[model samples]
Target: MFEKFRKKSVVSESSQLETLREVLRRNPEDNDLAKVFPQVMPLSAVSSAWPGPIERLGDLPFGVSWALADPQNYFRYVSWDMSRKWEASGTNWRGLAMENLTELSRRYPYAGSKKGADGRPFVLSLLNEDSMGPSRLLVPGLFQDLFGDDYIVAIPERTCGVAYRNGLVGEEALLANDLIDGCFKVGTEPMSNERFDPKRFWVL
Candidate 1:
């Protein structure tokens, strides 16, 4: 039933990413990603075991630099977006995000959704420390609450808990953390201050 999405896995990140890109390339219909995150293709592979590449700190996938960045656009490529099947189920993620953002915009004033890719709805919650209001915490849950839609709250470098929903797997999140954690020295932030390809970090 969930043909348009992939969930958690136990494989290596490189292998999964390669398989995902290959599947999307072969299918040639998931052109929606070309608009925003053209780097991320679709997936059809089911294997959960892969021989990961030997990685180092310099070789790790650099996450988006949170230093003086626009959280609105930054989040569009990261937050929870509904699979088409789930949308057909009548749970519209974009609508919910817009509604919540509309209400939250009354105070935060920096919430919106950018359609860089198709199918995936990237929700933005940009607020300063002073106005860290409900939207920061509530919006993600509201979007991910659709039936059969599973997600996890991930705080990238003290930023808001941007929901990593869409077709992302918990294993991918783990791989990201593992790569960053294993690379950096103790206590150093995994979400780096340098921007890297989002496709290298997570497979959507």
Candidate 2:
């Protein structure tokens, strides 16, 4: 009787975990998972408890992960099982993510260009409501379309990004670095403080 009870308890626990969350993908416009976006995260940012492994992005210490955004919630991470299923259904997940990212950028365009105290110009996208600011680095030609070509970006936190034209010199470069470091130190969802040249990657 004791062994039977233990087996029954194990089965019950397994069933409970499986039923804990029922992720449904009824359609592209489904409230459960309509908007899927690509997000860059440090290798250590994710907890081991997560269901999927983050795909490493080149040789960088970051990885490419998927996020699901809906109207009711801020956003949530997508596990490997969910992403694989989405892809197997003939929906190009990466392409869809890029499309959603483009739309998100359109909705919240970067604020007007601002100049540092030293007279160097830069652009900032620091929206507290939008947590995908760092993910902007994954979208090629995005900065070029808005601020022209040859630009570098610093995404210190998930909700903030600082960008400036390439070939910065002297104090201007120092200032950019300082800005990135400062944001990174204080950011809640700290991603990276390194500057990135979007031209290096052919994001599509």
Candidate 3:
């Protein structure tokens, strides 16, 4: 079961990378790279919409709220599943996503850009930090390296806000807010972590 889970995780990361690359390729000339990178969404709007569930402990550390902006707005909320007991097994969830993004860019250099309904170029992934997990330490640099300085959007979750407003209610909505807050940060320091070096990301 453990091996299977690892393999599944790897596959999932690869798929996400490919998806991001495809978006980049479609909108190669798109000017709004900032919109595609990870950042935090505002609480006011998020509070009004589907917030998801909340934890009694308050908030998680690495929560992530993401959206595919452009042709249509699609949203996803991410959090660490500590209940799975992966730490003892030597699994690093953070590294999984980063490695996947890196690999995808190498395999497909012209991903990230695509045309929207308006025929204008647009980026696909728009991430917001949720206050439900550890600091989103790797997000900014990951995006900057994969995309570009101009393309990265590392706004704190307090500013970006959530995309959806209905569907989720009660615990789900509150949980969603906590998740968003956990993922969101106030500045670019988190990206400066050793793992996300802009120099390493530079293609040429």
- Highest lDDT: give the candidate number: 2
RMSD (Cα, Å) for all candidates, in order, is 18.2, 11.4, 19.2
Per-residue C-alpha lDDT of model 1 across residues 1-204, encoded as one tens digit per residue = 111112334466577457644543454232132222111111221123211111121233222210111335432221112234335677543344445444543545333333323544333333234223222432323443321245433333322223333444455444434423332222122233232332333321
In Å, residue 91's CA in model 1 sits off its true spot by: 36
lDDT of each: 0.32, 0.62, 0.31
Q: Tell me the spans in candidate 1 whose CA falls farther than 4 Å from its real position.
A: 1-116, 122-135, 138-140, 145-148, 169-204
Please give, for residues 65-176, the per-residue lDDT of candidate 3 as tens digits. 3332343333233212321233456755334544543443344333123334555333322232222111233223433443355332222232222222223356544544
Q: In angstroms, give how far residue 106 of model 1 lies from its true place.
A: 9.2
Q: Write the per-residue lDDT of candidate 2 for residues 1-204, one digit (tens) a residue.
A: 012112111334345324423433322333234477877766664454445545666655566767787666455567666777776887777787887887777666564355666554565544425567667666666677645887887767656767777766676677667667777776655667777776543444
Which stretches of candidate 2 lie above 4 Å from their native place? Answer: 1-33, 45-49, 116-121, 126-128, 169-175, 201-204
Candidate 2 weakest ten by summed lDDT: 1-10
Among the numbered candidates, top TM-score falls to 2
The CA-based lDDT of model 2 is what?
0.62
TM-score of each: 0.24, 0.69, 0.24
Better of 1 and 2 by lDDT: 2
Of 1 and 3, the candidate ahead on lDDT is 1
Worst lDDT run of 10 residues, candidate 1, spans 37-46
Point out where model 3 deviates above 4 Å.
1-84, 109-204
